[model samples]
Target chain A: MKTINTRRTIRKYSDKEVSDELLDRLLTEAARTQTMGNLQLYSVVVTRSMEGKERLAPAHFNQPMVTGAPVVLTICADYNRTSTWCRNRKAEPGYDNFLSFVNAATDALLYTQTFCNLAEEEGLGLCYLGTTVYMPQMIIDALNLPKLVMPVATITLGWPDEQPVLTDRLPTASFVHYETYHDYTPEDINLHYAAKEALEENRRFCEINNKETLAQIFTDIRYTKKDNEAMSEGMMEALKKQGFL
Target chain B: MKTINTRRTIRKYSDKEVSDELLDRLLTEAARTQTMGNLQLYSVVVTRSMEGKERLAPAHFNQPMVTGAPVVLTICADYNRTSTWCRNRKAEPGYDNFLSFVNAATDALLYTQTFCNLAEEEGLGLCYLGTTVYMPQMIIDALNLPKLVMPVATITLGWPDEQPVLTDRLPTASFVHYETYHDYTPEDINLHYAAKEALEENRRFCEINNKETLAQIFTDIRYTKKDNEAMSEGMMEALKKQGFL
Candidate 1:
C-alpha cells in the first residue's frame, strides 16, 4: 500500500488519456472486491467519449472534472440483475426495498473507492462527484444506462496539475469508540476544533481568512436542509421510476 | 496493488502476535484515504487485547474471528468532529441529515475497504463482518463507543481456514449501462443466463442441486420481502436513534 502522504485529491489533470486497457483492468479489479453474497451487485460505467462526458458534466452540477478529466467512471446500485435472475428461475422478484437499495448502493460505493485507490497507485489524480447520483435521468440518458440500475456516485481521474493541500480532519479520539456509540458532547466538539485549529494554525482552505473554526464553517455550508432536499428528491424519484424504491 | 487471487478471509489465527507499529501504520494509512471534502469524518478502533475481543465477540454475532483473530478493527461513521468544528466558532452544527449520513457512512466504508486491501497486501486474511453495524448497543457497550460515533462494520484478520470458491458475477451487460437505466424484459434475463452457462460450462452457484438458470434462483431470493425485514427494521431503528434518520 502507498503511504498516506502521497494521497491527495487531484482536481486538475494533464492532457494525457486513460486508455481502454487501463479502464478494463481497473473495473476487473473492482469486480474482484468483496460484496454481499458475492452477488457482484454493482458495475462501473466508463465514460471516456466526448459526447458522453459532455452530457454527464451538467448532470453533476457542471463540475468541470466530469468532462475535463481524461477518465470518468460512474458506479451504480443495481437490482435489475437480481430481479431478472428471479424471473428466469420462476421465483418472485422483490428487490424494491430500503435494505436492497442500501446493500447495492454500499457495494457500488465500495467498488468505486477500490477503483480510486488503484488509479492513485497508478499515478493518477481522482475526484468523486457526489452529486452525480442525484441527476439520475440526465446521466442515464448521457451514459445509456440499462434498467434496474441507479447512479451511486461518479469519479473523475487523470494526472494531477494542481496539488491541493491536505484538507482538515476531525480529531482521533472524538470519533473512535472503545465499544459503544459514543455521542459527542459540547466539550468533545470543542476539543476537536481546538486540535483542528492547531493543525490549520490559522490557515483557511489555503490562505488565512480569520473565519470561524472549521466546525462552524462546515456546519453552515454542509448541514442546511435546502442544500440537499432537491438532490434527495431527484434520487428517490429516479429510483421509484426504475421500480427500485 | 496486490493480485486479486491471493485475497482470502482469515478466520483461524495462529498464536503469533500482531505488532503495534503495524497496527498504527494501518490506522494512519487507512484514515488518510479519500473522503468527501477531506472531512476525514471517521476513525478506527483497534483491539489486540484478549479481554477486548471477549467483550466485543457477543456484539458481533459471536463470530469466532472476533475473539480468535490476533487483531480486530471497527470502522465508525463520525459526525462529532465535524459538529465540533461548527460549535467552536460559535456556529450551529447542522450536519445531521440523510446526506451527511450517506457521506460519512460511505467514507468510513471506503476507508475500511482500503484497509482490507492493505491488510491483504501484507499477507493478512480478512473477513469483513457485515453484521457489526446492525447491533449498535452491544457494540457501543463492548467498545465503549460514544454518541454520533456509529459502528459501520467490523473486520477480523489472521489466516484463512476456508478457501471459498471465487463466486461468479452477473454479466457486465446485466449491470453496466451505457447512459441511462435500462429496463429488463423477460428475454434479457434468459439471455444473461445463456451467456453465463456457456462460460461456466454447468458449474454454477444456484444450479448446484439441479439445472437452474442464475436468473431464476436469485430473482426468487431477492424479490422476497419477508426474508430480510427484521434485520432491515433493526438497522433503520439503530440509525434513527443515532440521529441519522
Candidate 2:
C-alpha cells in the first residue's frame, strides 16, 4: 500500500538533488528484476549533468521535464553485448529475427518499470518520455550509442515542485476479462470514450499548469501528431545499417 | 528497499484457495504501478478452476508450475477497449499502429511486474512462462481472446514447494554500458558463453527441460527452434484480417 499510494507523476520539479546513494539503490532494485535468460539485455544511462540533459532535451521535443528534473535516465536495448559473446564463442549471432528484437526491447522496458517503482517508493516523481522512439537517431547520436543499442525511453526524476493531481482511470471492467476477449459495440464505445474524454477534461494534471482539460488541449495539439514519421520510417533502414535486422 | 526486498517469485502452493477479497486487493495493487497518461491499456485474466489450469498447462508446454501454482494469471494487451471508445465518439479506431501495440504490450508487462512484486511481498513465488508468444493462436483461441486483444505472458503463482538456489547473473560488465554501446570483443563472448553454459548445467527448472548451458539452451530451444514460426508469420496476417496492420 505504501509503495503503490506514494507513486505519482511529478512533472513539476524544484532544484532538488537526488543523492548518489539513492541512485545506486534504485539501479540495484532495477537489476533484481528478471531478464531474458539472465542475459540482462539492457543498460541504464544516468545523466545529472546539465550538458547531458541539454543534449537529450531537443530529442524529446524540448520537454521541460528533461532539463528541470534533477536526474535523467535513458533505458537502452543492447544486443551488442550478446553479439560479442557469440563472436567469442565462434558462433553466428542469432539476432536476425524480429522476435529477438522485441524480446530485448520488452526486457529493457520491464527493467525501466522496476526502476520507476523503486524511485517512486523513495518519494521521487518521474515522467517517462515516450517520444524517444521518434528521435532514436538523435538520441543514439547524442548519447554515442553503438550498433545494436537503441534508446527506448527517457525518464526524468526530481522532487515534486507542484502537486500533480491523480488522473482518472477507465473502469476495471473496461479492460479486464474473465476468459476471453469481449467485443465492444457502438454503445460500449460511447460509454468508454465519453468517460475517457470527461476524465481527460477533468483530470487535475493540467491544473498544476493552470490549463483546461487535456482532451481540449489535445484538440489544439494532436498528441498523435506525426512529428517524427520520417525518422520512424527510417528505423528499418537504420536497423539494416546496424546489421541487426 | 522495503517493497523491493519483499519481492520473491512463488511457485509452490499450499492448496489453499485465494478468497475474492484477497484477489481484489491483489489486483488493485497490480494496477497501481502502471504507466501514466492513465491509458491503462492492459488486462488481467485470472484462471482459478482446475479445468482452466488443465487447459493452460499444455499451452505453456505442459509446465508443472501451471498446475502447481494456486493462481495462473495471463496478462494481455487490450486495444479492443480503446477502439470501442473511438467508435463511440464517431471516430476512426486507429489503435492499429505498431507503436500502440508496443505501448500496450509494455504496459501489460509492467503491470505484470508490479503484480508479481506484490505477490512476492505476500510470500508467493512465481514462474513466468515466456512461451506465450510461441502459441499465440492456440492460447488466443483457447482463452477466447477477441480481436485486438493478445496475451503477452502468463505467470503461475503459489507458495514454494522447493527452495531453488538463487540464480547467478552474468558479470554486470557483460550487459551494462556506461554511456553508449560498448564494443564486446571475442574474448567477452567466450567468457560469458562459457559461464552461462556452466550455470545451466546445474540448474533444474523442470522435468524434461532442455537443460543445457545458457548459450546452448537459448540457441537450441529459443533461437533455432523451428516449431512456431507460423504463429508470428501469421500474426501480421491476423492483424491484417482484423483490420489492424
lDDT of 1 by residue, A140-176 (tens): 6676665667777888888888987776555456555
Q: Is the docking of candidate 2 incorrect, acceptable, medium or high quality?
A: acceptable
Best by DockQ: 1
TM-score of each: 0.86, 0.85
Stretches off by above 4 angstroms in model 2 are: A185-200, A203-244, B1-8, B34-36, B171-174, B186-214, B225-243
Return the TM-scores of chain A for each candidate in numbered order.
Answer: 0.88, 0.86
| Cα lDDT, all candidates | 0.69, 0.67
Tens-digit lDDT string for candidate 2 (B71-178): 788888776666555444444554565556655677788888777666666666788777776666667777777777778878887766666555565654555555
Query: Which parts of model 1 have CA positions greater than 4 angstroms off?
Result: A133-147, A166-174, A180-195, A199-202, A205-210, A222-225, A229-239, A242-244, B47-61, B133-147, B160-165, B169-174, B179-224
lDDT of 1 by residue, B96-155 (tens): 555667777778888888887777777667888766655666776677655556777688
Query: How many clashing pairs does model 1 include?
Result: 44
Q: How big is the positional error of residue B25 in model 2, measured in Å on the Cα after superposition?
A: 2.1
Q: Chain B alone, model 1: TM-score?
A: 0.81
Considering the two chains of model 1, state its CAPRI-style docking category. acceptable
